[model samples]
Target: MATQSPFPFLDDLADRVGEALQPPPWFVHEAQRRIVLLVNHVLMQEPEAQSRLARHKGSVVEAHWRHFQVRVVATPAGLLDLADPAITPDLTLTMVEPSPLALARSALQGEKPQVRIAGDVQFAAEINWLVDHVRWDLEEDLARLMGDAPAHFLAQGARGMADALRRFAGAAPGRPPAPPSGTAR
Candidate 1:
């Protein structure tokens, strides 16, 4: 019997990122580090999972482990999940939504994405919210994983995601979307 490949998309992603950014090894390393850090932060904030995934790190385990069930995808829009129709996002955002974060981290950590993991197999329509908001820098390897789009776009998506998180964190107890810096609505 042959061993199964962990990340089947990695080879293709490597090619795409290599062709898109052609970044130095260090930059690629940095991007990977940042991605994992962001993912870790998302995982730590979940309700019942903080104790289980304290030690794992890096994309190898993150990409293959089933804890968070967060599968990184490369589409014309960027990275996102195959599930979650609401976030059918085009540009990749940090996994920051409370519900998705719980599911994603659980999947990545080799656990399960909620009790209905089976439903998560569905993919959603691609949305452009992240592309329209925020800013960021992308490493070549990271770009390739995202199908080799220009790095600036990915960076913007990241920024948008951060903005979304900031808004969520700053929102009133029962209200949605915190008001902007100095405006009362």
Candidate 2:
């Protein structure tokens, strides 16, 4: 049986609103710059990730999600730098799924979104390794800003909220409910 969304009109409305609120080119450029910086910061934290990337120095990688895209080139220092549009990317990754709602659902369920990858096999393998192994310790970062106790409390609260939402969403029709938070597998 095919299921229909309870509020199909809202989906159309959202699409219109998103189209009307497209960011200006300058704002997009700045946002992309910040994203690259953040990605580099995380990559720097893992020496193995940096070394892997360094091996592909000068190779360009472009990532696309919907209408937004960012191209980066591997640096000799095992870091990434925003790439000029003139440079042809050695690897391109395009998100196969475009709906934000679907993407969010997948994320909450701890699954990776479908992505179409093309180009150098070695570079792709390195990227996959980084994705599978590297993660930013948000709690540690928060502790540096706000004391350890507060950071720990905040993380716990966030985790609880996330778990609650996951449970609620997964309990809906056609979805399997998630295991209760903190329960033994």
Using TM-score as the measure, which candidate wins?
Answer: 2
RMSD of each: 18.7, 3.4
Which residue pairs show collisions in model 2?
none
Q: Stretches of candidate 2 above 4 Å error?
A: 1-11, 174-179, 182-185
Summarize candidate 1's per-residue lDDT along 29-108 as a digit string, tens digits. Answer: 56655774664444344422332222211111112222222334332322222333244332222333224333433444
lDDT of 2 at 50: 92
Cα-based lDDT at residue 87, candidate 1 = 42
lDDT of 2 by residue, 41-150 (tens): 89888999999999999999999987779999999988889899998999999988666666676677777878899999899999899889989888888999999999
Regions of model 1 farther than 4 Å from truth: 1-20, 54-185
Residue 68, candidate 2: Cα error in Å is 1.1
Residue 125 lDDT, candidate 1, scale 0-100: 13
